[model samples]
Target: MTETHATNPPGAPVFPPGRYGRRREPGRRRPLVPVVLAVLLLAALGLGAVRLYTQYGDPAYDAQVITYTDITDSQVVIDFRVTVPAGGSAVCLLRARSSDSAEVGHEEVTVTARPGERQVTARHRLATSERPFIGEVLRCRAPA
Candidate 1:
């Protein structure tokens, strides 16, 4: 006969074999909350990166002044060069206006210089009294 302690409740079995042991379901795991959170975080980061690229990391138009000369009779000549990132064409313009708000002139030219240094010459004639201390616009553009 086996010896037994007498603490069992009325009508209960004397010893329960697996009562105090922990049981695990091997194939049943927790839901993938952390994995879903990680994926959402990465997607947000990717969208932010794309927005930054479109907002601030884009290229702009490029140009420079090579030489400028003021001629007799209030005529000014300007030489400039421009470099385009992709396309290879440019246009030059000389704008002349009077200080007294009397006269205005816009001169346009075709520029065909290579990426480094192309020579463009533009001429403007202004009235002697209307020579602007605040001069005109010199614009360059990719050939359209």
Candidate 2:
């Protein structure tokens, strides 16, 4: 008696027709998508950083609080120094806070630097509705 056997190719194993669903070929990915997306993300981040720096970061009009004294139930005296360009002026925001971090008072003060002067010291008396625990110079900007 003689016996017969079936042979298959070296590639993927063959399945019986209709027994399994049709197979699909691997699809190609486009490399441009990720590059475009990354460029867009970076551009957005750069724009945001530039806007923030322009709005809040001015090295020429920097301000620092030197001392806070003459504290009372209804007022506080804030002594601060502002660094401005020579012969320039700056507008500073002053704030007073209570012991609980509540805003007791706020005011905007303008300081001017004389000729050949880059730093100017200013003192402001801020009025409040309640007692203040601290006085601070929030920020300074070039005068408009």
**Which candidate ranks first by TM-score, i.e. highest?**
2
74-139: candidate 2 lDDT, tens digit per residue: 999999999998888999999999999999999999999899999999999999889999999998
Q: Candidate 1 local accuracy as lDDT?
A: 0.54
Residues 10-122, model 1: lDDT tens digits: 67545444565643433678769999999999999999999998887634335565554574446555555555444345665555555566544556666554555434333
Alpha-carbon local distance difference test for all models: 0.54, 0.89
**TM-score for predicted model 2 compared with the true structure:** 0.61
Which RMSD values do the candidates have, in order?
11.4, 7.4
Question: In candidate 1, what residue range of length 10 has the lowest lDDT sum?
Answer: 120-129
Q: Which ten residues in a row have the lowest lDDT in candidate 2?
A: 1-10
**Highest-lDDT candidate:** 2
Alpha-carbon shift of residue 100 in model 2 (angstroms): 0.2
TM-score of each: 0.39, 0.61
Supply every candidate's count of residue pairs whose N, Cα or C atoms clash at under 3 angstroms. 0, 0
